[model samples]
Target: MEIILVVSFSYLSGSIPFGLILTKFFGGQDIRKIGSGNIGATNVLRTGNKFLAALTLVLDILKGYIPVIISLQYFPELIQLSCLLAFLGHVFPVW
Candidate 1:
């Protein structure tokens, strides 16, 4: 049960569409409609907003890192799985 919680949290955290949200909020543009149609920082960069791209990059990295660190305290055995699932979640987000 604890493992499940950790994994779910990790995945959900990583799945946040930071790039998309920031792009739309600040630039009023759909991130997916520009560049390579990706929701990652690189695509966000194409919106001509360096700050948004940098912020998205940092937030995205933090989402993955924070979950793993939190899991380490209570679910040490799940650290590796949490990291991998977090990445997969970013690639194929539930959102």
Candidate 2:
């Protein structure tokens, strides 16, 4: 039960499309329509806003890291699974 919650939380957190949201909000561009069509920092760079891309990179990393950190601190047994799910969510997001 606890494992399910931890993995789900980690995946959901990592699945957030930070690059897409930031670019659309600040540059009014759909990130998916530009460059690599990816929702990562590299794709965000296509918007010509280094600051937004950098922010997206940082947030993306934190999304993956924070969940692992939380799982380690509160559910050490789930650290590996949580991290794996987070990566998968980022690469193949549900959203």
Candidate 3:
């Protein structure tokens, strides 16, 4: 049950779509409608907002990193599953 909860949290966190949220919050054009139509930092960079791009990159990294770190500290046996789920969540986000 604990592992289930942790993995679920990791997946949800990774699926946040930071690039899309940042672009929209900063009053920029929809990131998905521009360059490559990806909701990643590279696409965010195409929006001509370096700061937002960098921020998106950092946030995206954190989303993945934090989950693994949590698993490491509290659920070491789940580290691998946590990492995979995080990546999958980012690639196939719920949102």
- Candidate 3 structure quality by residue, lDDT tens digits, 1-95: 97888879889988999998998889657889999999899998887889999999999999999998988999998899999999999989999
Candidates 1 and 3, the one with greater TM-score = 3
Model 3 per-residue lDDT at 78:
88
Candidate 1 local lDDT, 1-95, one digit each (tens): 98789878988998999998898888889889898999999988888889999999999999899999988888899899899889988988998
Least accurate stretch of 10 residues (summed lDDT) in model 1?
A: 2-11
Candidate order by decreasing TM-score = 3, 2, 1
lDDT of 3 at 21: 92
Q: Which parts of model 3 are misplaced by more than 4 Å?
A: none
CA lDDT, candidate 3, residue 92: 93
TM-score of each: 0.93, 0.94, 0.95
The alpha-carbon deviation from the true structure for residue 14 of candidate 2, after best TM-score superposition, in angstroms, is 1.4
> What's the true lDDT of residue 68 in model 3?
89
